[model samples]
Target: MAAPAELQAALDLLRGLRERHGIDVVTTAQAARSAPAQAAALALRHLLPADLIWHIEGHEVLARLASGDVLVLGLDPSPRVNGRAVREGRLRRATIDEGSARAVFELAAALWSNPKFLPEIEPIGTLMPPPSDALAVPRGMEFVSAMARSDRPLPKVVDEVPTPGWLAPGLLGLAGPRRQAFERTVWNALRFLLLHELGHVCLGHLELGARKQRYRMIEELRIRDGAAPPKAGGLTDEARRALEIEADGFAAARLFGEAHERDASTGLQAGMLSATASALLGAALVPIIFHAMQVFSETPEPLSTHPPLWFRADAMMRAAMPGAGTGALLDAPLRHWAANDALQRPLAAAGHTHPLLGQWLGPVIDGGLDGPARRVLAEARFARDGLLRGRLRVQQQVVPSRGP
Candidate 1:
């Protein structure tokens, strides 16, 4: 595939995805709600060839059109928000669901609250503490009663900045470097994801034999009712896996860019390396842990448009760093997520559904929601890091890392 013709085709696809995706783009307020994802797109945008004629949709998923245009789906902020404030000397409450409200408020905090939308951080009122009663309500109450007036008024939809444009930093529950780490992870993972799609476009697979079979296969998948069997149009699982692997390779290569140069006399290299590691694993977490997809099997993937998440993550590391081994890149991320207890947070938040969801999700951070990815990343670290030539190490037993 690296032969010149294939190479040029791939180059064209990459250029087409990046350049043609960003032409004459005008960003609207709603489109900017996905600041992290958009920032990732823009970062990729900055790296592309200047002559390319792509214009990014301020909102959309990654897709290439037959017309040579592209789309990157972004976050759309909720048109509505909750909380209360006294307006013209009256207390007003919003009718809202608590969970959804919390998630949106958290997102708003993670995003627009950061001061570094210029480049780096998340915030909410923690930058300044408002009384707990201001945000709190009687348990399970749909409408919140207003608290005594203070310098900072209660959060309301009207208070949200219109057209936050991703650059507007927001806050979460975090403080200090912990906050920075979360923001960096948010930005980096989304960037790596965009890179993977760019990889597909770059490899020219979208226009090539066998790989181009994705179009027909997509139509097959779209056949929701039991009309006809889903078809691969002669695209085997192996071939599809190869295409996905190639795309992941594209993402990994750029995701780890120029870390050594930053190593200089200063200590910036370490931070850069950590950020890159976050990107690689963060990309994997999306489909595996977050989206609740079926876990990858020990076998080659079945017919699908892409490889499984674990496979993609492992393939990506192996392709990019080769002999350096993938374990180095995975250990810290795996450990960090576990130590922070992040993976379980959602299941916990699910209330009554937590038990069934946990079983479905693979409760052991060592293996389940989708176990194979976590296991593979862990094993790669153990074997390559030389902790064990035999058996796998679970989250409970830490393999002293040579660390990702």
Candidate 2:
């Protein structure tokens, strides 16, 4: 079926570009029947390639372009986005090939696919020492802070703590099947991300916004459709933010087929713990890590054109497992943990008085110095202690009218 008006716009651009540059969205079934041309276009929908143009014998599709009407572009390896589309009068050409977008997504996939290395510090989720006992932290928060930095900036955990060497070959590291598991995670993520760009282009986000390119981190940046600002080609950051949530819905639906919106219990409830499960959880945790990196690197808010970390992460998980609810809160397990006064006593006896420290204590099957994936499961708080939660809170206070 022809796409919606938004997606149909891409075809219009394709026709226009063909009129100007004699290029089309080639496919094996389409005009570009040559193996090389077909491969390049197929690659756009699947894997990322080093270069857009691949030399193929017995192919006249590209050879015919030797007349300088078309450019066979390659992927842009850098994941950091620095472009925005602007509308203009007349049939002017873009300074950069929109096809290069595959490169940026490929780069993001490579980063997210990387294994969790040893010697990483996990992010702090609502955990800290009281002002009265800041100097005398009985829990290892002080130690973690000291090890992470001599002059820690209040929050000890940045995005994640160092992956335990012990768990490297076992639970966390990309060893054996874990590597494959993580790769799958990256693949699913790429589908969501790349399709999102398609969503933007087809949705006509580029033509609606200012013709100037704007850079944003891959974590939050997304191609989206939104209400155009009042001024012609005037892109409002708020409008862009709203667009992200909409695009996320579009991406999630296509990535994960329609499932129940809310499942009261998922496999996690059945004590399903495996490298694959961890890999999936790790995939869910990726945006959170990148968001923390953005904070650490001090990326400005102007680049933030998407929903907050909590919203995005929650959306992904909820889509993946209906009713997962942000992946921050463990509904059933959390309830049991909260009610167990005995659990709190043991945590207190162990000098883990901070309520956040509850994340560290659990039974053998549940947790034992929870690994990154397990810790994610154990974490039952957002809005107050989450890295994004803190940011979201401040944002809500500042812009009291923002949507959840």
Model 2 — which ten-residue stretch has the worst lDDT?
56-65
Q: What is the lDDT of candidate 2?
A: 0.32
> Tens digit of lDDT per residue, candidate 1, span 49-165?
444423333532233335433323232222222111000101110111121222223332332233322122223334422213332221111111111112244333322423322
How many clashing residue pairs, candidate 1? 36
Q: Choose the strongest candidate by lDDT.
A: 1
Estimate every model's Cα lDDT from 0 to 1: 0.34, 0.32
Tens digits of per-residue lDDT, candidate 2, 106-147, equal 222222223221112121121121223343322223222222
| Cα lDDT over the full model 1 | 0.34
Superposed on all Cα atoms, model 1 deviates from the true structure by an RMSD in Å of 16.5
As a TM-score, model 2 comes out at: 0.38
Residue 230 Cα positional deviation in candidate 1, in Å, after optimal superposition: 8.1
